[model samples]
Target chain A: MKITAPISTPAEVEPLVRAGARELYCGVVPPDWIQRFNTSGVNRRVFGNLNGYADLERVVEKAHALDADVFLVLNAQQYGEQHLDALTEIGARFRSIGGNAAIVADISLIASLAANVPDLAIHVSSVATCRNVESARFFAGLGASRIILPRDVTVAEISAITTELPELEIEAFVLNDGCVFEEGTCHTVHLPMNKGGPICIDNYQFEYQSAGGGQPHERALRRLEQNDLDYKRWLWYRFGNGFSVAPNGYPWGPCGTCAMPAMHAAGVHSVKIAGREGASERKIKSVELVAQVLRRIEAGESEEKVREFAVGLRGAPGHCASGYMCYYPEVRSRAVVGEVEAKVEVPA
Target chain B: MTIPQSTPTLPAPPGPIELGFALVDERELAAFARHDRLTRDDYLDQLGDARDCVSLPENAEPTHFFLGSEFCEHLLPSVESIDRAVALCERWGLTFGLVTPIACDGLFEPLRAALARLPAGSEVTINDWGVARLVQREFPDLRPVAGRLLGKMLKDPRLPSATWARMYPNGLRAGPFREILDGLGIGRLELDFPPFGAADMYAGIDFPVGVRAPYGYIAKGRICKLGSLSLDTPEKFSPGHKCRRECLGFSEVGARPGTHELHTSQRGNTMYYRHAAGMATAVAEAVANGWVSRIVLSGA
Candidate 1:
């Protein structure tokens, strides 16, 4: 079982690289980051205004230097033709950088990328809503090399898929937060405005637009009636069936712990930790600790001894405990998703 | 009585051309009764008109006289229901088929299981992949009609733009319905349209006016009534309501009193007549032109 983690900063990434981290994944940079960081002002005309490529390139180069893999998340679900075109450009750059990063869930882009660039390995994003082995086989036939298994399946379902499709690599999300509504089943991403429900981050651009529209207090009420609002109305949500929102917030990312380790044990090509937006430090530590414990497991250490080692790595003071991945579930909680309480110490 | 020598031909190709009508409920069937639109007599009557044929359901038994030698689709709720349907069709000497929402699980399986009981030459239609996969695996004779909603295949972006010609010659393009139907391969392949909603935008006809049938009525967020269009029920079929039910998969909240609207945005507040008109035209054309052979009425 190969274990991988997400590391944002040079500080966090260096240790994990040496620790033999197998892979790393991260999100696109915020639009304002180029200006905010006193860099050349960013504009969409040159690079379509998406400036996150440099950061991704840097991470890929560094990780590659350490002989580790880097996965770029072009995982935004809602996009149009233009957005897909931009992705095609970005994907080309990703391939050019000697980056082996496979995109996460984002079907439209997958369709586009598959058509535009067939050589790029297609990792069926978790959100594509593949549920059964039949569906997984369909994706595999369609040239998907691996599938980020949905978070809601029983271990049996996972096992069955793995057994049924030996040629296909199965990746699972381990560290879970609250809620198991599963990725493909939840339409929270496509949920209509309920006037009463919390603002739907179902669409990140919509969330970004709403967030940037004004102050938080004002945006809250306006967002409830998002359909009525304009200006940022350019963004629209697609609510097709077979779409689900996981217990995690609107956009479901990976579980950082249990899933990655299990992926390793299951001989999943790579086990990935989910967080990338922030918590670079926690991301590094979590990956390192998880990898350490997995090494011991691979070494035939007693499950109990491995459990003790995990406790120290993932228990309180674990980087993930605070507000990095999910707000709920303490770092040391016994909940399956809270931390690998048995084998790995979850960092506070 | 002078027995007609030939069915009234719609003026076309030599072979018996297939003809079908959409139905959502029993009221629509009974409404056809009111107009003397179709009956057992019409069964023989239509024989001279067309050779190939299939008739959609009308909240009624498959043995109904209007459906003759051609296939009949019944919306069976369960495998048991499918068994009953198969038995009835055999007794009546009619071709049998099943129409079910993909969302319904139990309905498809039993129908597939009951396929063995069906006489040597019976047929089945499935809208969901599970049933289609199962039926195809179990019974090679199973004829699957890709449900309109389920057949909306995502354009495989990996395929070269040039390869689409080979992949989906009649694929529905990504624009309005005309493009969608044509670009998505749906137009090329035979499929059923959702009953009583929008139809192919390119169709240039309208449903026969003054046809009355029981319609599901929602008022003030609740189903206050259910009856025909002419019944003057308390609730009316708001275009907005219809749009929500058909496109958005939910009921629209707080639509303006006695008003209906459609817009590009699923939940947009701004009302656009163009969008509404487009949907209306598509619905009318599908019915008038036979692009849609069946209509599965809901809320009836």
Candidate 2:
């Protein structure tokens, strides 16, 4: 699997490419666009984009020099009619800057780009939420050359989609910013980080109530309920503990140096490392660490060795006990349940 | 007398537009069908049928039928299911719309097959652009409604305290986004009313809108918690073997004092907000402003 790293600045280009990234993707929020629509143009980055277009052009040019391709992200959920002209211009600039493709979320924008900027490859952002094969085929047919699968799907689902739609390239997240909710459909807005960002992960006012109710309702609960909760027992099992208990798997942490073998076997075209707004050190480390693991996997190292390496690199061993921080929760779950030393093949 | 001249009596505000409820399984549909009004008791039972949406309510005929899944692409009903829903809705003179989720690949052929069976002017809510393109191309007669997912409404659940009040009162939509929706051949758009207020945010967007009930869905997962929630060991409730349609049973979980709420419950392998709510007047006012045309009365 090829490593698809995030690039925000020209400085990140060389080190990331040298680290392991064969492909890089970046977002460009030009000042004019920002001044106009007041966002990175519907991007996932509500804090604002990491780089400007001129900087993006420099990043792309440098990545190209290193034989790595750069994609321009314009993957906001909506790009209004007024933004379309500016959007078309952005696409033109990216292509002119030698950006490999443009990752888009809106269908209208996808249609617009495909029609107006035929030369620029159009990739459907995971924000489009293309979960199934038909969805993949629909976008591939509609002109999106690639589908970046959402973080919620398992390796098996990814394999199924890639298997069915082999013509379109499939990319899946392998590192950074793991989501509790499926990204595209999640409507909860994040407050500015200083205000309390990474919102929804640890927000307050939410509560779950007992399912018990009226006589007939009570009767049905006794008869049909299998996973009923104990409201009286306040031992953390009440209305909805899915978030509080599991905390939605992991935070915007790492998922590097693991799941390589399964990802390769699953036939994923690319594995993305998500952190365009990351610190330079964090960004470089993520790319380098994934690259090291890839090298080991390429050398046919055991899954145990690769995992051990990753755990140490992620600093999970003696220091951390939170398995929720696991990169591949399936593998982690299997490791605990099956009592194996974490070298087994992940479920596909 | 001139000022009081009957104030041009505005057409009685269209009688709240016949709010339609969405069900996850046949049991809820049956309850809706059997009862004149779903009791609080009936609603509690309906919550248990988490992983599966109701097959057409053979008895209870909603004004507009949303006959499909919204979150899980895998849970999409068979083409046969769509065919049956379309036929039944047609017989009832009810408008049948396939409530599509944000999915692309696995649903194409099934949707197409179902569309072939649908009469002209049938609606397929487009949550994914790929679905939109397919509906535009192969299934020309089937109308596409830009789904709420496409609208990208900024939803922030409000707290009781005034500390966070400043974070909200935000607004969405403008001339350009509305034009884009129109460009997509979307005469209608599905909307989810936010916590604080939405009557004004959605004011100028002129497309006929279908507003989902008081509760807006915040976050959901592919592996539904209700689908595999184990009573014995909660930790074991990972996305294991999908439940045998036992999600009908609902449970309540909450934090003490000041806890930020994110209620989730599974409905046939997909999850919706378990405690989503909004005021009736907000929706009524939306209808008054022509911002709403249909009401998707969802699970409370």
Q: Against the true two-chain complex, what DockQ does each candidate achieve? A: 0.04, 0.27
lDDT of each: 0.38, 0.59
lDDT of 2 by residue, B141-192 (tens): 8789887777764454533332333232222344444555565577787877
Best by TM-score: 2
Candidate 2 Cα errors over 4 Å, as ranges? A38-42, A47-51, A210-257, A300-323, A326-328, A331-348, B1-19, B35-62, B73-93, B96-146, B158-187, B195-207, B231-241, B244-247, B251-282
Q: Least lDDT summed over 10 consecutive residues: which range in candidate 2 chain A?
A: A231-240
Query: Given candidate 1, what's the lDDT at residue B124?
Result: 41
lDDT of 1 by residue, B73-129 (tens): 222333454455455445545455544433222233445555665554444433333
Q: Which ten residues in a row have the lowest lDDT in candidate 2 chain B?
A: B1-10
Count residue pairs with overlapping backbones in model 2.
46
Error of 2 at B169 (Å): 14
